[model samples]
Target: LTCERYPVRRLPFSVVSEEDLASFERIVPGRVVTDPEELEASNVDWLRTMRGCSKVLLKPRTTEEVSCILRYCHGRNLAVNPQGGNTGLVGGSVPVFDEVILSTALMNQVISFHSVSGTLVCQAGCVLEELSRYVEERGFVVPLDLGAKGSCHIGGNLATNAGGLRLLRYGSLRGTVLGLEAVLADGTVLNCLTSLRKDNTGYDLKQLFIGSEGTLGVITAVSILCPPKPGAVNVAFLGCPGFAEVLQTFSACKGMLGEILSAFEFMDAECMRLVQHHLLLACPVQESPFYVLVETSGSRAEHDAEKLGGFLDQALGSGLVTDGTLATDQRKVKMLWALRERITEALSRDGHVYKYDVSLPLDRLYDLVTDLRARLRPPAKHVVGYGHLGDGNLHLNVTAEAFSAPLLGDLEPYVYEWTAGQRGSVSAEHGVGFRKRGALGYSKPPEALQLMQQLKTLLDPKGILNPYKTLPVQA
Candidate 1:
């Protein structure tokens, strides 16, 4: 396999032989998948842009099984790719080479839940939406949400330290994730899955795996803090004259709603047009240069509604907003959110997508997008900007009739250079997977990169766990 040439520094290495296959079957039995047809789905990413050359896919149901497999693979100096829902944007969830594919799909199980404390513990492969449903039934929320909720797994979210729509209110996973249980590359299970809110221990070791992108270990289970579901929810879709008004409206809403404000998302006219044209979703507001989707959740419906209404009225009267629509019913609220959440899906349907999840100063975000759009106007079919505005993260995507070298070249260093110039992050939410490894230099210092390499060397040593990912090649 091509992965074998990647130079994993360890011992007992060789191609998979009959003896290895027999040993693997002894552990997983029927779950050891070698059929090309079955392995086909596991080798490709969600975007169908990258493909791996793996010949075997192993689905382990328990942490013990995973540990056992890793022990054997580590002993034999074999590379392993840990996969969750395969919905990662940065090609982190899929294999980069022909390493063994270790999928957590069959490990889905809810271990425990504390109603009073609002904490839930579950296996790594449980779907995000399923976890949300389980907790929502008890008047609690998962404290995290994303467009890929239906397919993305909690372990995957933790692996990437996923920040989603509710981040403005609930904060990042770094705060909400209480503890984690991970299986290290050497088959050692680091069990720290506690539900305690505060623990000022020496190292906070579990954090190493949170955004490590499976390089350090495979996340087996997670214990996360859930928030109580608000009794009242209000959503408003507002049209703005330009990006400046979007920022102004955000500041105004933040002051007006305070704690009740949960989300402040922004989308440009180009994105709305794509969503309407591709997804067939009708735009709720008049066509404008920009749109802001503001949501507030609180225990008191009357108070929350009054706050939202007052803010909208003031913004409109002050010319901060041009037109708006308020969604009071649950169905209407969902419909409004769909327009923002479904932008990714709509863009996928358009053409070959080059996605960038970057962070820039809130004031310079509009200028960045405008500058990039002007630069790529001819080579790129469409360039759209939208994302969690309140968090300063922008999902800048460019679509082309087909993937071309010129189109990609024009977007790189230029976009990354611009972000770096503004002291912004090249990757705000998405981890540095195979796709963004080369761009790490733009965001990380040389010393930091050296330390990351040293850590990867110490953890895996053999470079078996998700090789060629997160950290770039050290000179």
Candidate 2:
């Protein structure tokens, strides 16, 4: 039924017969999971939009184990889905139908950490937050931070090229991840996991798998450059009279807070209302048309505080911020952050949620949410907008009592068309999983998509790796 709902047809891949399970067991003994109950979570995605009937789930702990499983699957022309944390918004993390699920749950291990260089080498299955804590304890910090950090794995984050809260400061993982270890589709081990910050080789081959969404290879381990942990951090929750004022405030932040500004995020009142209604989390600032969360991280507490204090004072004095609150301590900072980070949870509690993560010019970012609010009229419970304002990414969400076809009909190509009109990306951080493959052209040109297809064929000639996903369906 789930397969019928989508457009993709089953590829000419082998079904997991008992013989295949036996072969997989030999590669990772005691780890071949076939229990339907155990396979349930892996089959469903984070947003519950897609489901797959994967009959077999393989847990491989080492590079050799992964290489063996992939080699066998590739040789037999069996479809495979590589899963990590299963917290992706797009429908890419699960099998579309009966593809085998290759999980990285057992591959978690810290390979090495160099304190002086702030470099960390770790297995792909290592949880992002755990690595954050590990590095923080060693006087460094993971350059990336996201809401699902507690559960999302480092490999998944890199697989999706996740751009989270810290991108405004440390930049995307493409810049921070020095090297990686990946297994090619046909079982060749490609190890480029070097801890160097600067290396100009013939070609940066590891970059291919960074955001390929597992269609090219399975990322086994990564070597990344970590910045030293900031000694001082500050959070400010502010309310703005309108979107224009929000823009002015962000301009002020980039000018005054420049180097220390770690993140600049914005949300509409609809988002705040849902956070209060479902999660019962009270809004920290007085009600306003728009809200912004500005975070600053620096080396010296006194210096950062003085800089933040002046920034806030100027924002208020210029009426850039209608009202605001600042928190310097850790607990209060997290509580305020919960206002932004817990939005996905609140949206979930509302009901079935249709999420759109897009990149647009800051001036035009909120326009789509506004456009949909007018067009959808009713039935759509909420048309909420919020996201990393600093990076020009917006998380547009629409919730209803349940999934509705008419509502979807009104949203689909219209949203994609609007994004194309602005020359914006249909997906910013979330990779083009199954559901979004059709819209990949809105962001990437035909030539770019062609090149991507050529690369996919070259790296995964069998078309057995993550089949029916990532690549655009028609082209």
Candidate 3:
């Protein structure tokens, strides 16, 4: 039998009996879902590629309910997959077998907000954009923003340690996320939700669950530090002559714009073409070998505009950028961002996508893309490269007419080997889901991986939480 189809062996602990179901129904009336048809939507991932056969989907409204459900599941040896907005790129959000899914969808409540400290505390299932809207009205913005903001949950963001468009200016969740409350594998509630900026107390335990991908626990609540919304913003889309010019333009902009520069995103000609052709979005810049989207946010409109214009002037004067378009209005800014944010969606529409999110030295970023393109050769229709250039993270995506074993084989060791050679990370923003589990050794040493395994064994002796996911099997 397949690993997933293996029959469950009854344990000594209590199982979900008819009476237990009755108790669950009474506790959270009509919230627990058992219908197969209704559970189908949550059984799959955002990619529509990975599917799971979850028997039950629990929507717990309060942390107490979550605690109770997990306590029962722990004793019953029932594997649980904690789902957020279900927008994860990897199959981490969905179940691999017949595990029960515990979704935080009903726990979408804002607990508290401190305007003076710019700290916002909300339930784990809260949609990212909803929190952004709530804080934006209070003259503050969430430290992080991404294309999936409309669908991804704050809890998912914390789980993945997502680095998005705003990372260039506002920094990562590691710095912005103040505290987290997560339920352990054995139903122990870990409440470390402190809003304090500086805490020199013992081991920073919250960091463990930040990027654990729900293997260690289910995050119940999140306390994040928000940044004050910029009073004015300016966006400029520039088409560079080549990768070399793109780097030069970035340096020039960094020097000229300094702290005001919020984002420095890069895209190649093929990426822009895919976005234009697939999404029907008009390209803002003239044809070029490469394109860059530069953004500046500051307290004054005139200052932000001047900073962008000054940087552009220097870039054009130095031949770093060939053509450009600047946007001052909010409508135009959104239009420009759509070109960058929608590239992933456009690529998805093309064909089967093999996605790789890697972090290399900023200087060697273009080399990896160029090398991968040469290695893929003819069968791979297109190998496009783009991502948060400022953070030295590259989203190297390959699109093919069909998924082929040969294509995957050629890219696997070569890509990971190249990344490791440069003292870079194999998985940058995306966590080591099933797709990248085998490549964990490329980024992490044997000693570190051993420690990780030790911790995993200590936390989950039964291996019930997200089994066969993040960690790789021993040789």
What are the lDDT scores of the predictions, listed in order? Answer: 0.90, 0.92, 0.86
lDDT of 3 by residue, 306-327 (tens): 8788878888888889889999
TM-score, candidate 1, is 0.97
TM-scores of all predicted structures: 0.97, 0.98, 0.95
lDDT (C-alpha) at residue 56 in model 3: 77
For candidate 3, list the clashing residue pairs, or say none: none
- Winner of 1 and 2 under lDDT: 2
Per-residue CA lDDT of model 1 for 38-149, tens digit only, reads 8888888887777777888999999999999999999988889999999998988776666789999998999999999999999999999999999999999999999999
Between prediction 1 and prediction 3, the one with superior TM-score is: 1
Off by over 4 Å in 2: none
Per-residue lDDT of model 2, residues 1-475, tens digit only: 3367776678778889989988888899999999999999999998887889999999999999999988999899998899999998889899999999999998999999998999999999999999999999999999999999999999999999999899999999999999999999899999999988788978998789888898999999999999999999999999999998999899999899889999999999999998888888888888999999999999898888898889888988988898899999999999999999999999998999988999999999999999999889667989999999999999999999898888888989898999889999999999898878999988898999999999998989998889888998774
Error of 3 at 364 (Å): 1.4
Better of 1 and 3 by lDDT: 1
Tell me which of candidates 1 and 2 scores higher on TM-score. Answer: 2
Distance from true position, residue 275, model 1, in Å?
A: 0.8
